[model samples]
Each structure stands twice: as structure tokens, then as C-alpha cells.
Target: MNTYQHDWHTSEGYDGGLHHCRKCKRSHQGPRLEAHDCPVSDAEHHAVAWLGHAGLYRTRFDAVRNFEQSVTPVSVDELFELASKQILSQINEGCQRG
Candidate 1:
């Protein structure tokens, strides 16, 4: 199977347009943060597993580190779900403040 490799950093400063959340259909505003490289791929494939909004990491090691620090022994899918909710809550709070 052929795999596509992406350099996520290249798009960091560029306004590639807004991203819409598939589950919530909420418009994710502003310039998106670049996905960190996957440590498993040695920084080749920027594999992004959605968490809350989106967690960007440069490596699998970093992703694991984040999960370890932020969450308990949950599966990736569960972690992502939790993270997504966390992000959405933060955003909602910010909107309320504004």
C-alpha cells in the first residue's frame, strides 16, 4: 500500500482556509496549527488523530507524552473524544467572555 507523506509545517504560516469539524459541524476559525510529526515515522508523516479540537504533535512520542500528561489510561479514540470536548469547552468559554 502506498502512503502519502506530508510536511505539515509548510502550511503553518499560510492561511489555507478554515476547517470544519465533521462531528460538530462547527467552523474552526483562524489559521490552523500545524500537525506535529509522528515520531514513529521519524517526522515524515504528520499523522493527526483528532482529540477534542485537534492536538498537534511532531512525533508519536510527543503525542504519547501529551496523552500521558493530560489524560489517564484511555484508548486513543477515547482520548481524542475527551480532548475534543475540552477544546470545544474552552472555545465556548472564550466566546462567552468576548
Candidate 2:
């Protein structure tokens, strides 16, 4: 796993504003000031990890067609769960086959 120091200001885009962290020489905006001026931990970065989980196909046309015809909603959570179950089932099937 790649590791980097929590440089919130640089990570958040260095804007010259009041919320900028002088120590880190960076800036923040909106409600970000309320939180600590450090990047979130890897384990806590669920959104990034969730992006890798496949769900709906590309294009709105395909998505609509799938939804209308196949009844497959583009739900990320559902897709992740389905993929996980398929993987586990495949592993179990392989074990049985062996």
C-alpha cells in the first residue's frame, strides 16, 4: 500500500486562504476547516475502494435498457454484494471440484 504523510492542505488543493495550514503550507475550503488538517486514513477511504466495485454498464442508454428490460438497477452496494457472493461461490465450487 502506498503511504504518504497527511498533508491535508496540499492534498485538498493549495488555495491561498485563511483555512490554509501554515505548517503544511496548504489551503482548504467549505466545512473542511471543522475537521483536522490531515488526509483520512486508507481504511477510512471507503469511497475510493468502492469505486473499484463494478456495477452498471457504461452509457445512459445501456443503463436504461438494462433497467427496463433486465431489471438491473445500477446500485453499487448491490453490485458489490453480488460480485462478492459470486467470487465466494466460485471459490467453493473450485474446492469441491478439486
Candidate 3:
């Protein structure tokens, strides 16, 4: 079920858009693409980098709490890794299909 887009947006994994940063704790502002809105540093353009982290943590936590009650639940870190892999795979698959 093409869960790539749903997973990424729902989990908030570095989609190259402004989000709620845990460090700076700012969302989007001013223009749409301008990094200056939440520009904390050249590397960290957004103030909401922690949003994805928080999302992944929550997603994984919920997965464990709901599905893996009888088994070992995936850790937050593991969820991030899984999201990354799934996204990359989806991108590559898209490229190939296109």
C-alpha cells in the first residue's frame, strides 16, 4: 500500500520543509522556501528538526504499544533507520518506474 508518502509525512522525517524544531522550536514563517524563517545555522536551516525525531519516537512507541505487545518493539532509532530505508527504496523504485 504505497505507505512511503504517508509514513514520511505522518512521521515527519526530514522532508526538506519547515517543521517544528525541538532545538530552536520554530515552524515555518515569512516565505515558503526561505530558510531564513528558522535559520539557526547553515547546516540546520529549520528550527523544527526535532519534529521528525519526536514523530519517529511517537510512531515507534505507538507501534510497540499497540502491535508488538507480545514481542520486542522496534526502538525509536530503529524506526528512523526503517523510515530512511523505506523512503530511499521508494525513491529508487519511483525513479526506475519513471
TM-score of every prediction relative to native = 0.28, 0.33, 0.30
How many steric overlaps are in each model, in order?
9, 0, 3
Weakest 10 consecutive residues, lDDT, candidate 2? Answer: 44-53
Candidate 3 per-residue lDDT, tens place, 2-71, comes to: 1111111112434554445443445543233323333233222221122242343233345455544322
TM-score of 2: 0.33
Most accurate candidate by TM-score: 2
Ranking by lDDT: 2, 1, 3
- lDDT per residue for candidate 2 within 1-98, as digits (tens), equals 33324434434434543355533445556434544434533233322222222344544355455553432333456557867998999999999999
Ranking by TM-score: 2, 3, 1
Candidate 3 lDDT (Cα, whole model)? Answer: 0.42
Model 3 ranges with Cα > 4 A deviation = 1-70
For residues 1-98, could you state the per-residue lDDT of candidate 1 as single tens digits?
Answer: 22322223222334665554332233434665344322223222223442221354444466666663441224455557868998999999999999
Worst 10 residues of 3 by lDDT: 1-10
